[model samples]
Target chain A: MSAFVSISLVYLAIYTLSAWSLNLQYGYAGIINFGWIVFQSIGAYVAATTALGSPTSGGFQTYIFGARLGFPLPLIMGTLAGAALALLLGLIILTRRIRPDFQAIIMLVVAIIAAEVVSTNTALFNGANGLSNVPQPFNGVMHLSYNNYQWFFVAFSFALCIIVYFGLEWICRSSWGRALRAMREDDILASHVGINVQALRIVVFVIGGAIAGFSGALLVEFLGTWSPDAWSFVESFVVFVSVYVGGRANNRGAIIGAFLVPVVFGTMPSFLPEFGYPGLSANLEWLVIAALWLTTFYLRPAGILPEGRFIARRTRAREQAPVMPPIAKQGSVA
Target chain B: MNLYIEAIGFGVIAASSIALGAMGFTLQFGLTNVLNVGYGATMSFGAIVAYAAHLTGMSIWLALICGGIATSGLTLLSAKTLLRVYAKRGAALFEMAMVTFGIALIVEYAIASITENNTFSLTIAIEHTHALGPIRFTDVQLALVILAVVVFILLDGFLRLTKVGTALRATAVDPDLARASGIATGRIVTIAWLLSGFLCGLAGGVFTIDILTVNAFTGDSLLSLVIVAALMGTAGSVRGAALAALLLGIATQLVSAAGASGYASAVAYGVLAVVLLARPKSVQGGLVADRVQITV
Candidate 1:
């Protein structure tokens, strides 16, 4: 029970990080990244390969490249991998002024193709079986009991989450975050106002991708496995749903959403007694998630905790400053 | 050379299935302005329904019709009820797409749970094999090709000749204007949904026949190709969709024949990506925010 509690805490932290990253991209920036899971999966694969060292010729798993990197280095490389991929995709997707829906479909297609490529190219990530036996960070040096280590990892993950949460809060409340909202509402107008919409979009995309990568690395280090099944395209939707349910453009909502959706509702089924066939519960879980998504959209489009209006101090001062603007309007009307 | 020819032959068969689905997708998307990602799930549902009909001792052809009709009703009902609810609630184009995706998940998992997550093999006895030059096709494949051609002709005729078809075209172009011109836009949209849904279902049946397998995810797996074909073609242009489908079908088969069967679909998607990158104006014009109102 303690192990379960620790693992659930870790998952909650990881999912919260993912939801925050996605909220940064879609909720704030208005970039509908339908292929969000690919970024996370890429991060996991990179971290696993880097930490797993070299693969033997007839070993249990085969990957494209391997290295015996130290703990921090693998995580850093994973983050970089995600950022680089986001850069590549952003250049392709955001460089042009395609319709938002078209951009989304492209991202979805990319996710699907990436999954297919990774699963089919056995040399890349050991085919559908995926890369397993990923080395845990600090496992050998700590010499702690397994349960104690789990708690340690959970604490480590939650610490990172707090850091990310505050970092995202700082960013979202900045002038640049306001620029993202402007772009999301109207890019043409935002560009007219000299916001450099394209550049801002790419930058935000990279940042979100890095965060997603970091979360993926942390999760893989704890679980010690990464597979295609773990990060399917549908998983991206799960995060999207979390962001939607939690409240778009609100970091606290993202955390709440991650806890409620992926952490609570996602794990609730496992605790129930097995009544139906083996896979029925899993399918039913997905069905309920999808239904909940629709219900959220219908009942609470603004989410449980909608984004609060952010009135800057200067704006408030300007609004409060005495209304002396009727002179020209009265003259014009006369 | 023979290998390439054989690939081309197989490409024709694949194109028939793709064209059917792409045509329906493009037509409805152009008219309704909803991406309808649930389309693939609806196709899967239709195929499963057809399989069930076949199990009930119905002829395969009749079963296909049943599947098409069932999907048509489902599509119409969803459009009239579920989609309309979202649209009325002010969901934009992207949000509507997300809604459809949610619907897709519900339907897909429902099917998965009912089927026990098992893939069912579809068996239809092939009477004979027909050879054309270096290409060989079974009877079923030949029938599918003929079915595609016949549907295309009928659809083309309907779109070109009928007044309702003209209304559909007009509504697709401008809904308010079509209404101003005394066309009942609502009825036309209903027709669009039903017709497109039927085509989508038929495509699923033909695809199942080609692959000889049925599963909850089968249509979704084929959806990328369908979307590729639909986007490659001009929206609402049946001929363009058919031509694009043919092109993609041949490209995928040739790529597979070149020994990288796994990346065949990727190659087709690459073409779309390149098209999108090179000529965004031709494929998807500059961002028109809120210009496309969901018409469901």
Candidate 2:
């Protein structure tokens, strides 16, 4: 039970990080990154390959870019790889004024094709079987027992999660974050008001990609394996559901959604007694997730905790007059 | 040379299936402005229904019709009921796509649970092999090609000659104006859903017959190619979709023949990217209205 709790805590951190990244991208910047899983998968593969040591010719598993990197280096490389990939994709997809729906479809296609490419190119990442036996960070140096190591890892993960949570909060509260919200609301208006929409999109995309990559690295280090099956296009939908359910543009809502959707609803089913066929529970879990997604969209489109209005601090003159708030409210009403 | 020729033959067969699906997809999207990502799931459901009908001792052709009918009803029902709910709730264009995706997940996973996640092999007996020049096709393949051609002719005629088809075209261009012109836009939208759904189901049946396998994911796996074909063409132009489908089908087969079978779909998508990059205006122009209103 303790081991399960440790693992669940680690997953909670990872999912929370992913949801926050997606919230930054879709919820704030209005960039619908339907290919979000590809960024995460690239991070995991990079981290696993870098830490797994050199591959031998005709070995049990073959993968490119194999090296024995130190713990922090692998994680850093993973994050960098994610940002680089996001830069490349964002340059191609975001430079133009494509319709948002069309852009999303292109992303979805990219994700599906990426999976196919990875699975078929065995020499790249050992094909469908995927790369396993990834070395754990600090396992040898600490000389701790397995359970103790799990708890240590859990603490480390939580520490990172807290750091990311606060970092994102700072970013979301900053002027740049305000620009992202403006872009989400209306990119044309944001641009007219001096926001470099294209550059802003690419930058936010890279930041979100870096976060996704960092989470993937952390997950791969703990799990000690990375596979194509783990990062299917549908996996991105899981994170999207989290952001939508939690509440867009709200960091607290992202945390709540990460906990409720991926951690509670996504993982809790496996703990139940096996009743039907082997994979029935898994299928049913997806059904429930989909149903939950639709229900959330229908009942509370603004989510359980809608984004609060950001009213500017009142100046002395404004406070004395007290005239602008009603006008603003009337404009919104009209 | 012979390898390329044989690939062309295979491409033609593949194009038939793709064209069927793409035409239906483009038609629905043009008229309704919903991306309908659940289209693939509906196709899978249709194929499953056809397989069940075949099990009940019906002829394969009749089973295919049953599949088409089932999907048509499903698509119409969802459009009238489920999609209507979301649109009325003020879901934006992209949100509607997400809604369809959720619907897809529900239908796909429900089917997966019921089917026990098994890939059922379809035993379609090929009675004869016909050779035209260097390319040989089984009886089923020949029939598929003929079916595609007949459907294309019929659809083109319907859209060009008929008054209702003109109304659909007009409404697709401007729904508000069509309504002002005394066209019952609601009825036209309903017909669009029913017709497109039938075509989508037929495409699924033909795709299953061609592949000779049935699974929940099969239709979805083919959806990317369908989408590419649909997008490569103009939104509402059947001719453009047919041309694009042919191009993609031939390109995919040619790539596969060049020894990288896995990268064939990627190559097809690459073509779309190039088109998008080169002629951004032509592909996306006039398709997206300044204000996108869901015409359910």
Candidate 3:
């Protein structure tokens, strides 16, 4: 029970980090990244490859980049891998004259095709079997017990989550964040207002992709395994449902969503007693998710914790303006 | 050379199935203006329904018919019930696609739950093989090719010759104008649904038989390939879609035959990505975002 609690906390933190990234993209930027899982998978694969120290053809496992550059480095490389992919895909997808639906289709196709390619190419990323026995962070130096290590990792992940949460908050309140929202709401109007819609889109897409990568890197370090099976196109959709349920443009909403969806609902079915068959609960989990997604769309499209209305600072200080603000503001305005 | 020829034969057969689905998709998309991502799910559902019918002692041909009808009904039902409901609420094109994905998940997993998530094998006895020059094929493959040709011809004739087809064409071009011209665009839309659904169902049945397997995820898997074909062909052009299917089918098969079977799907997607990136304007129709919603 304690072990499970520790693992769940780690996953919760990881998922929150992911949700924050996705919120930045879909919630604020209005880019529906249907291929979001691929970014995470990229992070995991790169981290595994970099840390596993290359493949022994006549040995146990095979992968590229055999240099096992201990902790933090692998994680950094993973983040860079993610950013690289995002940069490429964003250029292909965002620097174009296309509809949002078309963008979604393109991303969806990319995700599906990517899975097929990764699974088929046996030499690259060990095909579908995936790379396992990944080195844990500071496993060599830390002489901690297994469960204690788990707790430490959980704390480490949560710390990263707090950092990411603040980062997303900073982006959300930034002028650039306002630009993203403006473009999302009305691209035409945003353009009219002199916002570089395409460039802004690419920037946010890369940022979100980086965050997704970082989250995946953190996740794999704790779990010590990475595989194609871990992330599917459906996994991408599931995250989208999380953001939708939690609320799009809000970091607090992302935390709430990540915890509620993956941490609570996703984990709940596993703990339930056997019902009809072995895979019944697994299938039911997806079915229930779809139902929840549809219900959210119908009942509360803004999700449980909708984006809070922005309050301008000037308007916020107007309550004390009865004596000093009118003349000072008028003088400044003049 | 013989291997190349054999791959071409298989490619043509595969193209027949893909073309059938693409045609139906083009018709629905062009007329209704909704890119129904659930089309693939519906296709799989139809195939499964047909397979069940076959197990229950229906002839293969009869099962095919049953599957087609069931799929059509299901497609119409979804369009009328779910899609229409969402569209009425001012859901944009992208939002509608997302909604259809939700429907697809339910439909696919429902089948998965029923079938116990096991992949069912489908084997129909292959009749005598015939050879002409470097090409060889079973009677069933020849028959499938013929079926595709016949479907296209009949559909072309109906759309070109019939008054209702004219209304469909007109409605596809502009629904409001058709209504102004006193054509009951609503009834035409119902007919369009039936026709497109039938083709979609037929395509599903054909695809399952060609692949010789059926599973809940099969339709979803085939969705991207079918979309690649449908989109490559102009949005509503049947001939264009059929041609695109042939191109994709042949390209993937030839590449697979060249000893890289796994990258074959990727190769096809690579082509789609390139074409889409090159010709973004073709998909958008115009900058105005004009789309005619189907009442049926």
Candidate 4:
């Protein structure tokens, strides 16, 4: 009922943010960041650690940077944590012009290894069980109903999304975004145009990381739990599929694609008839996604809303004409 | 000292699996210039096929052949059918990787659905161990290492001596030039796919044998380690892959033995990152703008 609507809205908003963050990276910039989820995971982990206070007293979980930060501090720290990882990774990968595929493989490997570490290290985010019972902001002061909380979250997240959307849109249309587009089309040409291709890539990458961090923070604040299950390599693919299916290089398309895939394709299966085994339906979900990915990849590689071509403004008739006196112009020839 | 010996033994055994997988991966990637992320899924498919055959009471040797053939057929079909379509359409390297990833997801999920995502264990009854000086080794481990060495020697010999192998190496270096020189580049690529696929399948089967478990995600997990080994070897060099595999296996084992259990995978990834940073050339392969193009 109303509670479900609230929860669903929160989920939708959070996923939209994640999708938008990815759009900034893969759409505007040609960087194939296959391991995008790692940034989000770091953000969630950091935000949780900061809010949980110290683990020295042997709490349920042990994590670094325990500080019980009140409100905005946790969210800010989350963004910083994600940006830090991006900077570190960018410094390493952005050094030379490696093949894009190799770059992707490296990211995928980093994410897989990262997930394994998080799951195995009991002291780090309480191992696979993850940190739970995280207190939501204003939960104590507001004393709101579950439905109200949902509405509140939906409103708050949408507000953040609007800011991010406008901010990202402005940035993409800016000189920096143009440089990214140029780089995407042809790095050599972009470089010839006096653009520092590598530097531009890193800048956009860090920005994308920041967005991812904010998205992760928003998600954790809403869900009240963070675990390894929340971020899987397959989940990364799901996001990629959404972006690709919706339209590459189109923010609106990306948002629409994200909503359609995660909500319709990903969530709808749960409500269907019980399959062979309990998890069979879940397994089939991935199969459908794969089929959808391949279909889109082959049929519409450019996506539904492809990158729009920039057109120049029309000039007046007089301006369009050469507007030269024929005698004066032919004097030299005569 | 015994613990160190045990780690070394395990490292050697693990290295055999990586070596086989890496050699196949390097060869396929070298010639095709495709990352082939679906390779791990194909490996898993091979392992499952072998496991199913074993469950059906087939001889282990026959199961190995069946798995190898099955993987080879799948690889060839994928390369000829789907990959060729994209390649013909001039898909970027990254786009190809995406395609392969999609294919892998499909294959893996299909297998998961079929198997019900159950973990099947295949225990090797190798209780007997032989002591060589201060180190002890199991029969299966010894056999695996020996098999890896034999594969290395045979592959090296083939590449150096045979006409087909010479054509493969020529094509690997320059497909267009090889084609201009009247070599059937298509046939060569197909043969490469078949051989590499067979080797990948064998690696998968051996991996399951060593781990004594078969699961859909087994090859997916092993893919990174194999890539590390392949990349470390500088790609296209079988000997280098084997040596790198040995190093990686030893390094991971040592890290785990040092009580840094959680960071062991991280340690391996750390090596990959270092290699990436240190040797960017290995990743680029002379193509500055080469987007990942994984056909099969």
Residue pairs in candidate 2 whose N, alpha carbon or C atoms collide under 3 angstroms: none
Two-chain complex of model 3, DockQ on C-alpha atoms against the true structure: 0.48
Runs of candidate 3 exceeding 4 Å displacement: A318-320, A323-334, B285-296
**Local error of candidate 2 at residue A99 (angstroms):** 0.6
Error of 3 at B95 (Å): 1.5
Candidate 4, position B42, lDDT = 90
Q: Using lDDT as the measure, what is the rank order of every candidate, best first?
A: 1, 2, 3, 4
Each prediction's RMSD over C-alphas, in Å, is 3.6, 4.1, 3.7, 3.8
Residue B29, model 2, lDDT? 90
For model 4, how does the per-residue alpha-carbon lDDT over A1-334 read when each residue is reduced to its tens digit? Answer: 6765666667677777778778878887788889999999899888888877787675567776678889887788889888999988988777577777777878887888889888988677888998887778777789998778778888888888888889877887777777888888788888899999888888788988887887788778778899999998777788888888888778888877787777667876776789698799988888888888888778888887887764222444556678775555655756
Rank all candidate structures by their TM-score, best first, as comma-separated numbers. Answer: 1, 2, 3, 4
Residue lDDT tens for model 2, A211-328: 9999999999999998899999999999999999999988889888898888888987787789888999999999999999999989989877778775434544566785656555
- Selected candidate, larger DockQ, 2 vs 4: 4
Cand 1, B chain, TM: 0.97
Backbone clash pairs for candidate 1 read: none
lDDT of 1 by residue, A126-161 (tens): 989998999999999999999999999988888888
